[model samples]
Target chain A: MQSELHNGINVDIQEYADLIEESPSFQDEQYAALVTSAQNLVSAARSARVTSYGSEEGNGHMGLCFYFPTQTDLDSTIGDAYADLGLSQASPIWANYVNSSTRTTNND
Target chain B: MNLVLATTILLFLTITILFGCSEDRVTRTGIEPEADNQTWGVLIYAAGNYEGDQLSGPSMSSSRAVATVRVMETELNSPQTMTQACLATPAAQGEVGIYDVEFSPRQPVGLLNSELVANLGSVSTGDPQTLRMFLETSLSQMHADHYVLCLAGDGHGWQGMMGDYNNELGMLIDKLREEIESVSYLLPGGKFDILALYARNMGTIENVYELRNTADLVLTSTFNVEQPHHKIIAEWYRDLQSQPELNRDELAAYMIDAERLAQDTSEAVFFTTLWNTNTMNDVAAAFDTHSAQTGLRPAQLRLRLC
Candidate 1:
């Protein structure tokens, strides 16, 4: 179902579903999206961890963990987790990454 | 004897006139004539393609306009190769003479990853080469007085590309620094007055030091990670063209105001500045005040590392 939330964010669960159904590329790859997302997540995680070390060399490392995930499982988990933390579904950076990754994985 | 002397004088005058005319022709066509001392030069470097991201909005139509205005205001002459009417000429005889150049490449959806990698490589290669070429050509030509570089595009400091899925902003900055140093080595005495970056997501305090290390001043937007508002930017260019004395802080304040107006019905707008120690810190301070007034937190990223 598609719905608009109070914080000016929009959520369309079916839109995610449609993306999976339509992508031919997603069909061709064997867990390609999953791998891509995992890589991104790993990179982001590493960046975040480095920054968390409080070293001067890692000052701008916070943004590293904030990347698009390519894996479906990770996408769903992260999305749901963020949603629980109050990030709206309409947030393009996080939501789009999650939706696209999930769609690619579902199609495969 | 008097008639002979008069005839000789007339012939000499005629020859001199003809030679002068020929020289003028050569200067007008083959070479740029010497500009007056009052003339200044501006170079605009528009780099990094975003394929129109959601946060930053869309690609700008008036980037060319900004370049053009800067050129016209400075009354400098641009290269024949940069035939665009709005682009300014190089400076006559200063560090500002050498200007770096970079361009963004177009990309489609599925090709984002590969395209990003390829373009990053090209950007790196082009960045240094462009600066080096500008320095060589400017010094040899000796036509510029000071140099100003405008790195126009979507920017996010320390982070890779802001709007695009493929770009790494950190990598791009590193490449730019490398190229700047390379150019500096080639032209040890030359100077870059400022590096005006027309981009987004780089308004915070942290980005300032990283950016200011390479250039005298860094001008960019604070938030709204998409393409900047065209009319606002055009207007800003117009103002700068009319009044070159406008300090960097004044420019930052204006950008913050524009950002506020643009984001009134949307999201928060932010921006900041990093100036060389010699530059007036008032501009950065003004930017902070404006950002705070608009409920946007100013990242105090200014440091004296260089």
Candidate 2:
């Protein structure tokens, strides 16, 4: 994940990839625990500044980003690099999503 | 008439002055004692040639590297703290220097009076060997109970961090972990107490997980980290000096507070994360399981524009 200007790249892909994984059986308790843990993490992150910008001055900064490529990104050089990563090979979650997006764009 | 009284008073004053000037009496000569074990040793590796032409004057003229050193000099003051910085700047021949930095009480704040300990003639800052060499030399020479290693430069996320413009090289993420691991044994707990990444967009799972074993705590940002904001690190040092018993978690929290507070609305997009290397394994496992259950769905994959 990269910023708008491409100066910075987000590296928190593991958590995002896990979030994409779905089970046959719904585990409410487990999901609740995950949510609680995520909330605790967010709470621990105390900011001194009243406001932090993401895209613009007023826009808030999102802490994490996952690899979910669109049709345009899939057709670009970045898509090739993304495909080459070990995570892409090990986990088909992101790859499947990218393929679906590409098919949707092609169909449109 | 009172010659005996005057002589006795002069003699007493002379004796007091002599005792005050005793070698045991501590004075702020600003020079650190030789071979003394320090409470903390801060090792800073800054790739200073981030901007400007290589053939021109040095790139550290007003770079973040020099600013970090200045912050350390002014804010980091502890008799038990030893600070060293290895700066890689683009000179006529691409100069790299190791400096022993200390706060000079004699001079006003904001002005650094650092000592150049050694000059490494033309070395690639992007090389893992160079980083390992610096770590080895600094850790072996500067004996400390705890160490904080600060890596400052531009980051390439998981690919690597730090760009050596002169040599046109970048240190790979895996290589970085290997370099630090090589010197981890010399550390008190077989790892650095804190690994502070003073680069932009290095708060990735790939890099952090790879380096989890090398440090107890990892301080980095998922987005662009304002280099000037790193002055909070010097403040953290000051706090650490005042409270030597502050644990790693507490210190990490303190840093988070300091960094967040240091930011203002004037700054654009500030986000930093303090990863506890101890629990990284749990995070990885839990997330892995969750990913397996959910799998990949187009409907679930929401595109975040930001």
Candidate 3:
């Protein structure tokens, strides 16, 4: 089971490294090694069994969480704060996607 | 006469330079002479009033803060102790106090049981300056070989934490990073040994990246933090007392092992993970690259995972 998890993490790491390779700034062996380490940590976290509220089967808690908010939440003051985050500011594509989604959600 | 005048001017300039460069020139030294340097000092910036109604009773947030202090008190060995924990929280009517966590066997006593070491007059926990002051005062007075800063309050991942309605302030992640960095600048090591987030949803890459330079290791939860982890920390405290030289990696591994043990013993699922902040920059950059390439909206990614 551990080997299988390790394999899955390697695949994810390779895919992540490939994406970074496309970016000119991060095209280095050091970046690849760091990505591998992070993915391994994330995989170890996801392999752990999490249980919430006395139920062992339905705990949805993952090892590493990302900022994914509902459209309403994204439109609120909290969303304003989220948009101002360094990550959001760094990734214009992500920011644009969020902005477009908010627009689409509002139109709907 | 000219020679005597030159000599006297040189002597006056030397005295002026000595006084100007003296430590006594700085007001509010933020140090306590009575505080003995210990192996580990844990400072908890606990804001209790952020979660529940102030009129009814102690909020769940405040209750958790009290429970955490109690757990520390139970594990702390007095008279020959190498671990010192302090609780800094808002008291009645806009008053904030940093209390010394002492070993007390009395039943049902809350934060009042601890000794009031420093009273920070009329400050909101939501303010970044308040956090800086708390850290500066505690770091100077606690006097530890290493330090673990525990932020115990309500959190919404990267949005904010430790909100104060009275002061109308919210402590954003950026402000938190700056506050910790400023305090670290004053420390000998220039960073905290460990930064433990007792709040929820703080394990996100962005939040961790923001705090990368503040601590060697960041201990936080991806979801709600379990109460059992407090006991895990207390256990680590006991281990620290025995070893007194546990490195950051060793301490992180020990806490992770304790979490795994807690999970094995019961149905409670814990999402606590420790990340080396040194590696967070590359992780965050890689994540940004992946996000840009995928062109997936944050919500859509969540939906796809679900």
**Candidate number achieving the greatest DockQ relative to the actual structure:** 3
The regions of model 1 sitting more than 4 angstroms off are: A1-108, B1-39, B53-144, B159-170, B185-190, B204-206, B227-233, B244-268, B274-306
Comparing 1 and 3 by DockQ, which wins?
A: 3
Select the stronger candidate by lDDT from 1 and 2. 2
Error of 2 at A21 (Å): 17
- Considering lDDT, which of the candidate structures 1 and 3 is the better prediction for this target? 3
Q: What TM-score, to 2 decimals, does candidate 3 have?
A: 0.68
Best by TM-score: 3
What lDDT score is found at residue B40 in candidate 3? 66
For candidate 1, the docking band is incorrect
DockQ ranking from best candidate downward = 3, 2, 1
Q: Write the per-residue lDDT of candidate 2 for residues B240-296, one digit (tens) a residue.
A: 767756766666777777665555546546566676776655544433443444433
Mark the 10 consecutive residues where model 2 chain B has the least summed lDDT: B52-61
TM-scores for the candidates: 0.39, 0.67, 0.68
For model 3, residues B1-306, the per-residue Cα lDDT tens digits are: 999999999999999888865533221111223336565677777665554322223432335555566666555543223333334344445566777666543553446555676777767777888788778777766666677788876676777776554543358898888898988766659999888876766767678777878888888777654444455566666665556667666766766666554455355555566777766655555555555434434454431110
lDDT of 1 at A57: 28
Error of 1 at B99 (Å): 11
Where does model 3 sit among the CAPRI classes? incorrect
Q: Write the per-residue lDDT of candidate 1 for residues B119-189, one digit (tens) a residue.
A: 21222212345444443444343333344455555565434222222343423444455555555533323
What lDDT does model 1 reach?
0.36
